[model samples]
Target chain A: MENNNVEILLIEDNKNDAELAIRAFRKANLNNHLIHLKNGVEALEFLFGTGKFDVRDISKKPKVILLDLKMPKLNGLEVLAQIKANEQTKAIPVVVLTSSKEHPDIKRAYALGANSYIVKPVEFDDFSKVVTDLGFYWLLKNQPHV
Target chain B: MDNKEKTIELIIANKKLAFQNQEKEKRAHELVSANKELAFQKKEKDKRAAELLLANKELAYQNEQKDKRAAELVLANEELAYQNEQKDKRAAELILANEELAYQKELKKKRASELSNSNKEVDDLEKRVKERTEDLESFSYSVSHDLRTPLRAINGYAKMLEEDYGTVLDAEGLRFLGEVRSNANKMGVLIDDLLTFSRLGRKGITKSTVDMNMLLETVLSALNQSMTHNAEIKFSNLLLAVADYNLLQHVLTNLLLNAIKYSSKKEKPMIEIKSEQKNGEIIYSISDNGVGFDMQYGNKLFGVFQRLHDDEEFSGNGVGLAIVKRIIDKHDGNVWAVGKEGQGATFYFSLPDNDK
Candidate 1:
């Protein structure tokens, strides 16, 4: 059970939202390599292979990081800044997943090298569509530096 | 007689005659001396009379001068009296003016204090309104996320149920699921609109010179893409305005969309867009030959959640005009509508003319 081959790293605080996003990906048959971290600390800890994830390989980064803006302990923007600032993780595309467009950190997220931004829709169908579409475009269509 | 006396008494009487002659001579001498004295006295009297005459002339001249001096004094006294009267009049006017000035100063002081009090009240009111608007904004914003979170779950689960369990359920069950999804979606829109309405107070407007004609073109194209309608929107040489571009676009889109929807049933639904300059404002009017409302419900047209037509007749969440009103109000503009039952309606919004 190697966790090194993760593709989509979903960093969200709310359990329901995390499950829904996973479900949305699963519905689209794109949840094969997705990993869900409950908080920003865990995501960072998982990404840099530090503390609990020290033994894990840091080189095997996810294809895209789905970062939520509002979370407990080292929120999304800070996590994004750390990811973008590092030499090894800077190439990994980071997508901002926010609850509302009214989240004032929208501009700052982009400024911190977020690859894209998506507002989680209210309707499940639209939400599903958005999740699947991003999966398809980023995983299949978008080419990243190897 | 003296010679006879002198000769007669010759001899012895000669001596007596000589003595008598001597006495007579002495008497003559005394008479001569007295005559001389008389002459001298007469001369002295004549000189005294001349001196008296000169003194009399001097007295007459003095009397004449005194008379002239008395006349001059009378004239001077009259002048002094006139001057005193004038000075008295001036003093009376000065007293009246001083009282008036004091009264004016008191009035000015009172007015200044009143002005400051009202200004303070106005400042307090503005602060409260700002705080309340901010509260409402943050409330709606968070509610959008919080409410939508559960709503998404419900809608998603319902959708997942439909996709996964559609084969096991009846057709009625699928329809109910559809209803649920749509109602959730509508609630989402309503929440979004509420958020936008509250946000108007917090968002600062970035103003620019807007070409009305160009703005209408952009709006028409946008409206065309959003919904398909056959309403002929006409405008030419529309006036320009200095306002927030995006907010004004929002106002136009809502009004035009409403116009098209309200008039959809008409054979030839026509919408005329026009702009005119009036009273330091540029008023743009959108007239639609739609299923207009009774003029009685006109005031309610711009209220939040206020609808003249039922949901079945016109599909709307009743927030378009309210949004329009708020945007216009943020620009210090006015919005109103005039309609008659079943005839037509005219919606007008005016913005301050800052172009020139």
Candidate 2:
């Protein structure tokens, strides 16, 4: 994995979801610079350049962070709070992608400074379209803070 | 003196000088005897006078005792008369007190009856609200659990099939697959909207002084991001309202989105928002130059799943206006609309101005 140029960080715990999201990105040809972190702990470790990713460059921040709310350890809201709290990672666009739209954490996610929120559609095509569209919007259209 | 003269004449007839002397002696004796008699009579008179004086003293003492007894009787009579007057006054006071007590009892009876009637009304209202809430809760539960899970599976598996067998399938097959996926997606939206409607019924409103201008601006920015429309919305110096911030946001979003969607076909889609104070209520209106509905079906506009236009013309699940109606009703407000067939439409709602 080229850690220096990682553009999209997908923090998802479910194996099927990770695979589906990766496939969707690949279909849209946006998977080349994407990194899939299975849990929040590893996501934090990778972002901070600690633990197993200690040797990688820490300054290379992803253009967008696709976070899932429910996880086994250090759920998305906590991770989001940590991310937004740090000046180094505060500018990164964090999009909360979740299965349930009515999850009580949605408002909390927005309150915690998530840039955008999207409910993961059950249909594969719609999910794929959403991912592709978000990739295009954040990567191709939006101007990142320098 | 005449009796002595007669005795002397009888005695003097006997002898001249001697007889006359004896007669004189006899007359002298008789005079002495008469003097004695006179003295005894005087003594008796003196005793009678003493007895009369004792009788008079006894009568004076009796008169004194009678006068004393008569004074005591007069005092006793005066005391009895005073007690009778006091008793009459006390009886009159008791009569007035009894009348006042009876009046108070009558007032209490009337007040108790009114309270009982109000309690009955409150009990009936509570029962009706509870029944409707229970029905809404059960329906929401079923929609959330039974409906959504299967819809998820359907949509998920359909996508899997399309992904796994896309190369082998022809164009028509892909199109059919697309339809299935879209329909499933539509069903998901419908379920979501239904859940939102049901939740509004159960959710308690958290009130605050909401700045309508700021709230509308935020909603407009959000809508601008979600969809593209060419409607000129107008509002300035909007009034602040005390309401639930999030619920009011939902209300504004629905009305504004509807206005934009219905007026999308117009050459110049115009949406004007204005507010006025009327009869202790703040009335807010959103007017749009849209494809309006007939007044005949106006009563049915806010019903769930009641649509005025076909899906080809304007697409919606028709739960938006119902949610708006419910939110307004929760605020103790009223919602209504005025429109002609193809000219334009105006939606009006009033919230109680309780700040004053």
Candidate 3:
């Protein structure tokens, strides 16, 4: 937890799914200072240094943000728009994870500067592999200007 | 002459007497001749005057008759002139009418040509539609085959896990493996249905006079396994129809199976299979006393994999109605359903008179 520059920030409402994603990240050996926010609202508060994460340094933005579209309040698209709109968080990459490939707003998410899109796999093993691959690609492979 | 005169006197007297007598006789004769000549001239003059008078009267009568005839001729000429004018007017009107008829004929000719052009366009469109339909069938077939291969892999591995490594797996892991198997099986069913639908589109239908009553009976007998409940299936006097027998059988089986499946929840499910002839079309209906669907999803009923009821409530892949629709379409017929939620559903299919 020392020098906590969050490398992977996962914003998901479902606790089981969040736990599973974390497990997959660990299995892929790409887990490095990962933070799981319950929903878009918490993720926004964390990024802007408000609400529960007021003491957090806004300059130390996560390298990658994995967003779930269907959450309780403040959906992924709104969170993505807010993040990309701000100059401080604009460079951070956002990947959208959705349940339905036919979700109407997928194209809109890409238009609003989403880095990637992946359909949530129903099977557990496939889900884990997809999550691992995405973590690895964003965290290690792509050299983003911090 | 004196002596002779005296003697002549006596003689003269006698001669005078003779002379007188002669003179008297000559006078008498002259008188008589003059009278005769005057009388003759007077008579001739009178006859000539009478002849002139008669000729003048005859000429006057002839002149009067000619005047009358002249007046009549003028009147007749005037009548003929008026008749000629009327005839000219009629001829002019007739000419205008003929011109109009000719114009109309030309217009009709142009219209006929335009119709012919449009008919050709329609034919071209129909040809394109047929070609596209063929392409779609082949595509669907290829998709089905391709999709099944992956599904088989998924199913095979899951089965292998269960069969080969069942002892090593925990209870929850085994349950998860079962779900995987079931889902794969569902995918297999979906692929099979898609193949059936594609095949139906490609197959050329041969129609013959089919006994519908007998056909329904046969279909019912085939579906003997579906009749768990003592469902009363009543068939009225159904007339014969001209349709593709095999395809029609498929339609009936689908409907009958749906009836049985949906109505299994009813205390006593009553299915009434009836027929009616209207406007040269035979309508066959199957009504089931069952837990039916809402009317809002009516339009989506015949679409592939469009299910109104949840998988927990009714076990179906939702391709049955779509198959029924395709078959009915091939037979040049229509199919529809009317249902209320928690009530019942009546499925109707009509066959056009093959006499046409």
Q: Give residue B125's lDDT in candidate 3 (0 to 100).
A: 96
lDDT of 2 by residue, A42-107 (tens): 999988888999988978889999998878779999999999999989999999987765566668
Candidate 1 local accuracy as lDDT?
0.89
lDDT of 2 by residue, B1-356 (tens): 69788788756754676767888998999989888888888888888788888888988988998898889888888988998898899899989999999999999998899999999999999999899877767666655545655665667667888878999999999999888888888888888888888788778898999999999999999999989998999999999999999999999999999999999999999999999998999999999999989999999899999999988788888888999999999999999999999989999999999865
Tens-digit lDDT track of model 1 for B12-52: 58677788899999989989999999999999999999999
What's the TM-score of every candidate structure?
A: 0.79, 0.55, 0.53
List A-chain TM-scores for all predictions: 0.97, 0.97, 0.95
Candidate 2 CAPRI assessment class: incorrect
Candidate 2, residue B316: the lDDT equals 89
Error of 3 at B311 (Å): 3.6
* DockQ of predictions, in order shown: 0.65, 0.20, 0.01
Q: What is the C-alpha lDDT profile of model 1 across A17-136, one tens digit per residue?
A: 888899989978989999989898999889999978998899898889999887888889999999999998999999999878877677898898999999999878678889999999
lDDT of 3: 0.84
Q: Which candidate number maximizes lDDT? A: 1
lDDT of each: 0.89, 0.88, 0.84
